[model samples]
Target chain A: MSTTEPKRRGRRPNGADTKEALLTAAREVFAEQGYDAATVRAIASSAGVDPAMVNHWFGGKEGLFTAAVQIPINPAEIVREVLEGPREQIGERIIRRFVTVWDGVGGGQFAALIRSVAGNEQAVTMLREFVQNVLFNRLVKVLGVDHPEMRVALCGSQLIGLGMARYVVRIDPLASADADAVAATIGPNLQHYLTGDLQLLA
Target chain B: MSTTEPKRRGRRPNGADTKEALLTAAREVFAEQGYDAATVRAIASSAGVDPAMVNHWFGGKEGLFTAAVQIPINPAEIVREVLEGPREQIGERIIRRFVTVWDGVGGGQFAALIRSVAGNEQAVTMLREFVQNVLFNRLVKVLGVDHPEMRVALCGSQLIGLGMARYVVRIDPLASADADAVAATIGPNLQHYLTGDLQLLA
Candidate 1:
């Protein structure tokens, strides 16, 4: 039993070591190259792990990205899922998913993430690139919208603001409000940003 | 002249002493009673200074609140000014003023404020109350909106998100974009929150 316990502990640490190594390497690569440009093979090579280990540990590049970035949700997966639905309802879907996922984690992690981003320059850069390019930008391109840069910024602002108000600041009504209600309240504005006519600011 | 230096130094320290005392007391008082309820007399009394010192040192209750909160601009003054304009243009006015005041102070202060809010529970509560009650909630009431709570939250989210994107994270295009352009791009959305029909979340 003692011998088997040692082996069991040894195997888990070995697995954990690989995952740690991958996360370390992935943060550097993703911040430097962004989500679309950074690849599984490159990250694995950087971590000195087998290419398959990316899948084994993080399920894929998206999961790895989520872990490395320290954001609890799989933003890539959420984006893909959010886009799969009717374009008109995308705003509601994003808000609902956001509230559900963050609330699921007890919402404190959102504040922690904000603290990390506020204090760390690297985290800020990674999140900035992720919010602008990896997430909202991708959504903008898929929609084939004009002024993609502005749209992404607008969307980023509202979404991040909603998270701050509800989770971090715990603003009443909005803070205590349910996900469906939040979606209904803020969804239309988000939809307007996504699909409505916006005057070009530049 | 050399002997007179003692008197000059004595007078400046006396002035600074009053200012310092007021600020210390104001922080505690404002945090405790909020903007409207916390009177200049109370803060001055708490600091062991005369009520006139509130205006003489910091301009008035509004200015004292500004200094006490550590926010660079007078939110009360800004609110008063923004409301003086046509209601339809209020959103644009707000974006323009927000960008101008923060930008005037070089915008870095916004990040500093965020860092403070994220790390300190007291700062979080103060800001939450300020944004919801002192700022947006007042606006909702002026407009006589149906769902005042939701409107305030929606507006709070977008405005804070805009600040985070433009000033803190420094997200592209949005970050570098000119204020007029930003106002035009984002104003309509703000107007909707201020005056538009929003489906209630509760």
Candidate 2:
């Protein structure tokens, strides 16, 4: 060690350094043991920091995962943008927004999430939570529809399906089709899921 | 070698025996080397039979894969059943049939196919061909709709997405929902994709 450098022992590292350390540790632990088996205490210990640091920096495990996974876009902003339009066009707006965002980021995060979901319990949980909490719940509340849970799930199925075919699976025509074309084709389906009759039992 | 059985080297094996051997060898080779790298010659050698046997039995690599994978149900039959019903209710029938088939098989084949699709090129190709040829093409031909390709793709996305969510990823509610409930919820969306306006070129 350089003599000029400050002593590291017993001194609290800067917040940025601690946070980075925690993220690195979390990624490693999650990869190794998966989400269910990974513990906050273990992650903190691996980072050479106190367990409380995790709660302090991120509210809890879900918050920590949100940080570590780093889903490229803020879902809240997307939701807000979609809701700004006429309620009838909400489905079209949502589909367009989805295509634009995924295409904008080159679908790296979504691809990674989908690929990891098959074998990883943590990934599956993260996906379910993200869809239910971030995307579906908010829309369901805005729509104020009956069977909100089923509405959200149906919507999720369509959007997630679009993502899978166009991005992950790279199915032809859909994969290469322009965003407008895709939106136009898929928008109505999303509309039906969002506000149309699901034919569910009341 | 069984003492009662004649020496096996020079004789061309029986058709059933040779076909079975080729299928077993093809499965191992495909799993180990993936579809792109697994050659017919390699499979034949592994089966201890002449390379010509693959062509004689299954036509080629694609046919061999179809035999090995064995997707539990026939696509043609499902298409026929869906088509036999009234044109307006085709979507509901299709969704019901889909839920019934996947639920009947216990989702093993669907889960396996979805999971394998990510890393395996051969699996992706096979999936594309299966969807495009067996499912989509037949449906499009029956519907004789405008933008048949897009229609097929949109339908594929929803079904594939539902499978991923319910079986592969096991998202709650949708995953646990009975076949009837799932069909009721997702049926209309599928119907829309099948015969409803897609808003293409607008």
The best candidate in terms of lDDT:
1
lDDT digits (tens) for residues A75-180 of candidate 2: 7787788899688888888888888877876774566556566545667777778788877798779779877877777777888889888887777789888888
TM-score of chain A of 2: 0.70
lDDT for position B105 in model 2: 66
DockQ of each: 0.57, 0.48
Q: Candidate 1: global Cα-lDDT?
A: 0.79
Predicted candidate 1 versus true structure: per-residue lDDT over B1-202, tens digit per residue: 4645566566786889999999888767765544555688899999999999888888897677666665555767877888996889999999988888878767766776676677666678768878887887777777787878877877888888999999878887889988898898888889888898777743
Among all windows of 10 consecutive residues in model 1 chain B, the one with the lowest summed lDDT is B29-38
True contacts kept of 2: 0.57
RMSD of each: 11.2, 8.7
TM-score of each: 0.71, 0.74
Error of 1 at A120 (Å): 1.3
lDDT by candidate, in order shown = 0.79, 0.77
Question: Which candidate leads in DockQ?
Answer: 1
Docking class for model 2 is acceptable
Q: In candidate 2, what are the lDDT values of residues B129-200, reduced to their tens digit? A: 777777778988978888788787888899888988788667667888887788778877787788887778
Docking category of candidate 1: medium
